[model samples]
Structure formats: structure tokens, C-alpha cells
Target: MTDEVAEDDYEEVVENVALCSECDDYMEHEILKERKVGTGRDLLLKCISCSAINNLQIREPKSISIPFILTDGPHSARVELAIDEDEVFNIGDVFEEDEMLWTINQILDKDKRKKKTILAIDASSISALRTDMVRVKITATRGEQSDSSSMLVEYGTKFTADTKIDYQGEVWRIRAIHTGAGRTLKGTVESQDIKRIYLHEPPNPEHFEPKTPRERRQAWKEGRLGYNPNPEIPKEITKKRVTPSNKRKKKRPRK
Candidate 1:
């Protein structure tokens, strides 16, 4: 009886390096010539450090399929991404899929450890969020009158309280932002994480242009009377969440 040898016994490599035949050492080389062979590439290279000539045959980079978890607010879905094994990926990188753009928030390596930077082959899974567009809930108010609406904004749009902004053909000042931590008046919030935005009228309106010094002084006084924005705390909504009764099925009747 004779022992049989395994057909696949060598390690697969994706990097662009090869051993120099003349120097008998692995070294970085400049491509001198290249042509497509039957299943791979036939290439001639010269070592950069030793100036030695070498011949190398290489195959295409292996494809690595990684699990992609995409999220939008409370919704999430799983998808697969096929990337070249030699490609490098980093956090905050954006890629287009399913006709929308997504940004990488985190990556899990082969050991299931989180990482900010990793190679495509080393990444086991990825977490991403929609970045092309985000829906922002806004409330435009002028004391007694107010309008509540939602607007589509870019991912990184910044909103700062106590600043004036033009929206929906009207000028309004931001009053507060509701973030995951809570509502705040003096801090900035991104559009993606902003649950809601509160706004009031701008300090000066076009129709309120003052014709006299006294009118101007009065307008200034009115703008400052109740528009104190120094306080950062916001009133929290203490409403309790009620779970629907339909979540669990009733016990089956016994025969």
C-alpha cells in the first residue's frame, strides 16, 4: 500500500511580493514584464534592494465574503459583501450598496474582536449605518404658533442650539436637540443621532425692521427677554413604554 498526497497543501497569499531567485531572499520587486497565462499571470521582476532578476507567477486575489449589518435608527438588516482579500478597510469608510451609501461604524476580526482598521480577509463582520441621507424631526415654533415636520439631511449635518437657520422658506433659531443621552440646548448634535429638534423665531425678522432707535431698542429687549439660551438642560419626557399585549401567543388548548 502507498500513501497518497493531498492536492492542496500550500498556503494562499494575496500580497504583491515574491522571492528573488538570484538573491535567494523574499524582497519587494518592480514589475519588468507581465502577461496573462492560462489561469494566472506570468511576470518578470527585478528586486528593488538587490537589483536581482526574478520570475513570479501569481493568481487573482481571493474573494472574502463578510457579513454586513446595516442599521437605520431602529431598523437593521444583514447582507453579504464580497471584497478582495488583499483590500484594506477602515472605520468611517463609505461604500455604496443596495442603491444607497453606508458608512462603516465598526469591524469584527477573525477572533470576533472589534477593530477600527483591518484587512478584508481578517474581518469577520462589519457594522454600518446609512450615511447618504438621514431623516431629522424638527419643530419650528414662534411662541403660540408651531409647526412640526421632518426633513431629510446629510449624515454629518450639525445643529447647534441658539443659532439661526433658514428652513422651509422661513428663518428660525435652534432651541434644543434631543440626543440619545437626553435633550440639550447648548451642545451640538449630528443629524443621524438627533431624535428631534426644537426651534423658535430668529432674533430679528424682516417685517420687524425698526425705523427709529427706540423701536430698535425695544426689539432687542424683546429678543432677550425670554430667549435665554445659557441653560443646557431640557425637560425630560418621563412617559413609560407600554408593551403591546399581542407580543406573546396564548397557551395552546390541550386536547
Candidate 2:
């Protein structure tokens, strides 16, 4: 008899031959190109098992350049103050444009009397509950009357409220101060704007009683309580009169 090889044995040999490489594994590769400086260069390589182009290289790029400046300290000051024992004010509170300008002027005026100068500062609008902080932009003036020389004021520590401010005879609580963004000061209010304030009395306690569904349905069916108007009824009832008929001449006898 002639020697015979099994199909399974031939299949295994073919599979092993398909992966003939240094790694002895199948894989796919793609080639990437990069131009070299001062020369026309081409780099090429083949994947071992899959025979694919594996000429790609991953290289790190150069670092980016950034500008640096030396400064003595930060450019702003900030503070946080409590309002009416509730709410806190940070940065970025919207206030009336006029009110904000007025507050800034007040700060500058106070600083001026003390021989201190604040170039330009911005204040946020008052909060609804009269609570928020303020940011102040501070700069020193050049000459005795010149507003040229200035420097940013750094917040040494948080300044609490010494006393509340009365705006137009209305008391407002000061929350905090923020001098970070140029010169901005913020203050929180304990009360809302006078015009916007609304007063409402407590609801009557008698309206709080709960009614059962059955009781409500009975009231509706009896017509005692309804949204629509009740139909009108006559005050007095009228009696009706009836008359008997007498039309009988002769009646035939029935068998």
C-alpha cells in the first residue's frame, strides 16, 4: 500500500507556512513618511509575518514658546462679607450701572481724604437680598493732583463689616470686597431694591382645612354650591282646572 497523508495534517502545515516570519505572527502595518533636512531620504521596512510596509516612526515635536513677565504681586484685591446672616457674595454680581458708579466714587473719595489714591475701580450692582462682594481697582497718582501713578492693592486679609451702609435712608449690609479684576468692590444687601420689594400677608388659617371627596361631591350634586348661576323659580305655585266630556248618544250591543 502507498503511504497516505491526512487532510488535517496538510492543513496544519499550510497554516504554519502562512505565518513564516521572525515573529511568526500575522499583522497589518502602514507606512508613514517624513522629509529629512538637507537630503532626499526614504526609510522602508516590511512587517515580518504579514509582509506589510512598517516604515512608520513616531517622533516628539519641539516644545512651544510662552511669554513670561516678572511681577511683584497680584493685580487685584477681593473680600467676602455676610448679608443679613444669610447668603454670600463672591465675584461677578450684576448691579445697576448708576449704583455701581456711585459706590466706586464713594470708595475713591474715602481713600482720597486719607492721602491714598485709587485710579479706577468697578463695583457690582446690589444683590436682591442685599448681599454680595465688591472689587476695587487701585492705583497711585503721579503728582499731588495727578492720577497717573498707581499700583494694585493686594488683600492682606478678609475685611468684615464694621457697620451697615444706608443708601437713601435704607439700610444695606456690606458683604465683601474683591480687588482681583483691576479694582472692583462688591457688597451684598439684606433687602431688595425698594421699588421691587413686595409685601404679602400670610394666608388665612381658615382656608387650610381639608375637605373629603364625598363631601365635595354632595355639595356639588345638591346645587347648593356651584360655579354656574342657579335657574330662576316662581315664588307662587298656580292650580290647574279639569272638565269632563259628555258625548254619548247610543252604543250598539255587541254579541
Candidate 3:
């Protein structure tokens, strides 16, 4: 009873489309009728293979530019994001940009009210924090002053107390770990839980100081030091002459 529908002028929507009851799976379908509502499409579709009718409503996706703010520790940068009008974003969802993954922590609706979830059409802005890496704060105490710096470490990196670490072109030992609960002098903690790492600057190692050439000569002449300038050069060897073929220093007492 269905007319030859291809002869009718209807806009076709070709997506890997909706399920068909007769085919019992998704198959090619032709749009018999399509009406565009404010944000959605009401479509009457007939399967090309089985001639079954399916009425479906799909949102017409439109790109909406929303403000996306990315946070890194104390700094933040704002960027524009083009999301589909139908996109629904939830807190704790991850988004990737510039090879970094960020987790959505907050979203603001058009009224600037905080929301746990938001549709792109209603979202005014979104805030996300870096999740793939974290900046670990480091502090080294001197006699009176303290030096503070930060290092970027992979997320969940384990840091243990009394371990040597490299920072600012110097080697430091992790004296303690502040877990935000308390400082621990021993044991391990992951990156996320650590608030700040207390560091101990390693003591300068003692080394032998070689005397200068002038000082060496002066000390040797003063009988205060032994000088060996060319230690690598072999020293001449002198052999003592046999004492007059066997003359005794003093005639041994006759035995």
C-alpha cells in the first residue's frame, strides 16, 4: 500500500541509523517525512529493505561555542570549545585537549548557577582541572630561609621519604612528606595526596685539595710537604758499588 516514496521530495538523513523492528537490527532507512522543530527533528522513516515504518525524534545538533577554562594548579587559561547543542556533560567527565586530559569539576549554566550536569545548549561555561599530571610542591629549609619550588610529576606518582630527588640542578633528599593529614618522615605517598614535600639539601662532600705548584715548592723547601710534580715519569734508579770487592767496615773479631 506504500507509494513509491523516492519520487517524493524529502530531505534524507543518512546516519548509521536507528533500529528496525522487522529487520530486528539497524538497516538502511529512507526518510518519508521530516519536520524540523526548534531543537529536534520528527522523522517518518521506512526501511529500504523491509518497508517497515519507524517514527523517531532526533535532536538537530548545532555547534555552540562555550567558554572552557582549564586549570593548572594556581593558573588557569580560557579557551573556546565547540560542542554539539545536544551534548550533555557531567561532573567528573574527562575531556582531552592538547594531549592533556582534564576532568570536569564544575559547570555553570546560562544563569551563572552551578550545576552538576549541563547540556551544551544551556551551559555558559565549564571548568576542568588537569588530571593526567600534578604539580608537586617542594620546600627546602636552610639555616633561616626556605626555598620553595614545584615539580611536575605523573599522576599517582609514588614518593617515599628519605629518597634522593633531583631539583633545580641540585640533589635533594626527601626528608618528609606532608599528606595533608600530617607529615610523615618515613613511608610512601602518592602524588595526589601529597601537599608538599620537605627536602633536605645534601651536605657538600669533602675532597682532597691539591697544593699549587708554588705552594708545593715552598713547602718542600721548608721540609713541610713532599712534592711529586711528574709522578707519572719514572724515577732514576742508582745502584751502590760493591764495597771494594769485600772489604769489611771493621775487621771481624777472629773466631
Question: How many residue pairs clash (N, CA or C atoms closer than 3 angstroms) in each of the candidate models, in the order given?
Answer: 0, 36, 0
118-207 per-residue lDDT for model 2 (tens digits): 222221222221123222222222224322222222223233233343333444333232333321234322211111111122235555
Q: Write the per-residue lDDT of candidate 3 for residues 1-255, one digit (tens) a residue.
A: 135575475676767377999999998888899999887889999998899999988875779899999998778999998898989999999989989999999999989999999888999999998999998888997556788988899988999999998878878889999987899999999997899999987665532222688756654654445665534221222134333566658878998
Cα deviation of 112, candidate 3, in Å:
3.4
Query: In model 2, what lDDT does residue 232 have?
Result: 28
> What does candidate 1 score on TM?
0.52
Q: Which stretches of candidate 3 lie over 4 Å from their true place?
A: 1-59, 204-255
Candidate 2, superposed: residue stretches over 4 Å from native: 1-50, 68-172, 175-255
Q: What are the TM-scores, per candidate, against the unseen true structure?
A: 0.52, 0.17, 0.59
Ranking by lDDT: 3, 1, 2
lDDT of 1: 0.82
| Runs of candidate 1 exceeding 4 Å displacement | 1-35, 44-53, 137-151, 160-175, 180-182, 186-195, 199-255
Q: Top model by lDDT, which number?
A: 3
lDDT (C-alpha) at residue 108 in model 3:
96
Sorted on TM-score, highest at the top, how do the candidates line up? 3, 1, 2
Judged by TM-score, which candidate is best?
Answer: 3
